[model samples]
Target: MPAPCHRTPSIKMVRGDITEQSVDAIVNAANSSLLGGGGVDGAIHRKGGSAVLAECRALRAAHYGRGLPTGQAVATTAGRLPARWVIHTVGPVHSRTEDRSTLLAACHTNSLRVADSLGAATVAFPAISTGIFHWPITDAAPIAIAAVLDTPTSVQEVRFVLFDDAAYEVFTQTWREWKQ
Candidate 1:
């Protein structure tokens, strides 16, 4: 798919597949295992091919043996994917009993940090934990947008690549509210 338009104070919300985004980097909403699971993680691993998994395995062998911690991010080769790098971040699962908003926000903030370290000007991010992890899009949207906006980074473009209309609407609405 075509890359999203670049605008100053850049943040764009797109409804489509994250793997198709032709950006400098794409953020993977990965589980702690970082080995690959369902949802966005699986799609990225599949499309990015063995080179991606190979780097992930090397990461595990070298440093993340216990797996990546929640709210943390690590970068790997994008393999056959369009982007140069895949920033894999582990988002906290939603919990009714405990507030994990900070952890959720960390996923976005940390991913941006990694993207900046890689000198990636354009980055695409999925709504972290909003799928199998059960993070309600309503609550997740604002945090994701806020974290990206609040963080200091060199990234010129940030695209929240939502999987569906509902998520796209929520993120776009949240972004609009923030802009206003």
Candidate 2:
């Protein structure tokens, strides 16, 4: 099969809370349950308000009864969030004996696809699977950047909203390396 045609978007990195990002959509590194869990998922749900949960529940009841699977994405109203929508994507748990890089890449690609479908021109993403999922930041950085760079989407900007200096540095360095 032919590889997908890639598009270049304005990629930026920031060290801050993702909930504070003012964009068209925020990508939540969510658990499969989609009800909310630790790390980025919990923060997004907490700040986004009950309206986000309500839509999640409705989605669960209407379609995702078994819960959202890893690497797939779904969208909900952002509620009180600065963004118009939240694209929830479940990333795979890292494994020492198994290579799950493809699933990690899928998380970013799927979220972008969801964002494009919603006509979101700018999107903010957290480091999916790098927290409690135990995926190393170094290993995850390339998969994420490559996925976002390679995917064809109408979105105009993609921001990596890192929670700390270390993650922000890693992503920044990766971006530099990719550009070279």
Candidate 3:
């Protein structure tokens, strides 16, 4: 028999690229510019094609100046992925001078908020700042899990799609412990 889904607040850890995960929505770790950049951003843009950029440009024009606040998310069509919506979430960069806990929480909270707002039953997330943003993988693992655990939403399934072995291991280990 398949394992039952864990009931307590816990994140489902899976090994794969976030861009390819099939879910109602996928969270993109976007820069403040929202123009798309390296790492997960580039992969999503490349897979979703120019249409994603066009939609982002339109959003940028409409929501000018404010950009997107950390922990808050905005939605756009998936363009090419299996998912129908792309939730853009801005995660904090690990600059030594910046306090990123709140922003990290925001990343988790806002993504869930957007998904719940759209009535998505399932969502996929990438390790937000563990890439180019320099957030340590070990440190980020729990924060991501905590955010997902804290979100109050109709979302029934959440997948943490990790791009590499180290990240995958961290999420898996943390999730296993959290589940137990």
Candidate 4:
């Protein structure tokens, strides 16, 4: 094969809290409300402080009055978090009878698009929907990785900030396998 014409971003797997990531943007595994709730959303809201909530409130009052739809993404000031912007994407809940993986993948793709629009060179993402939404790590890992790998964006670096060993390992192994 010929040399690649474009750059594929450097992917990093850091087993840590996404809230503390010091990147240009951090992807929040947010709920539709965007007012903040359990898991990553709650942590980001608590750590990022009132300014984050203020922006979220403004977003709700403006375009998201009915709440953000699943798979779509929006950006807000990172507030006290180490990043400059926070890209919030609501992931779909896992359903056994119905395949909702496309929505999950869209969460990653749309978040990257929002990050690119902000000129964010680096972004950190949490394992969206794998927590409260109950998306299986086994199924979610490949979808997340493929979405990032397939999407075209200006971001130079993408880091998956996993909170636990299970999430981290799944991402790590999935990425390694995908590279082959």
**Number of the predicted model whose TM-score against the real structure is largest:** 2
What local distance difference test score does each model get? 0.91, 0.94, 0.84, 0.92
On lDDT, the stronger of 2 and 3 is 2
As for lDDT, the candidate ahead, 2 or 4, is 2
lDDT of 3 by residue, 133-161 (tens): 89998889888888788766667888999
Scored by lDDT, the top model is 2
- Candidate 2: where is the Cα deviation over 4 Å? 1-6
* Model 1 segments more than 4 A misplaced: 1-8
The order of the candidates by TM-score, greatest first, is: 2, 4, 1, 3
Model 4: how far residue 58 lies from native, Å: 0.7
Structural similarity to truth (TM-score) of each candidate: 0.95, 0.96, 0.91, 0.96
- lDDT string for model 1 (19-100, tens) is 9999999999998888899999999999999999999999999999999999999999999999999999999999999999
Query: How many Å off is the CA of 5 in candidate 1?
Result: 21
| CA displacement after TM-score superposition, residue 103 of candidate 4 (Å) | 0.5
TM-score of 3: 0.91
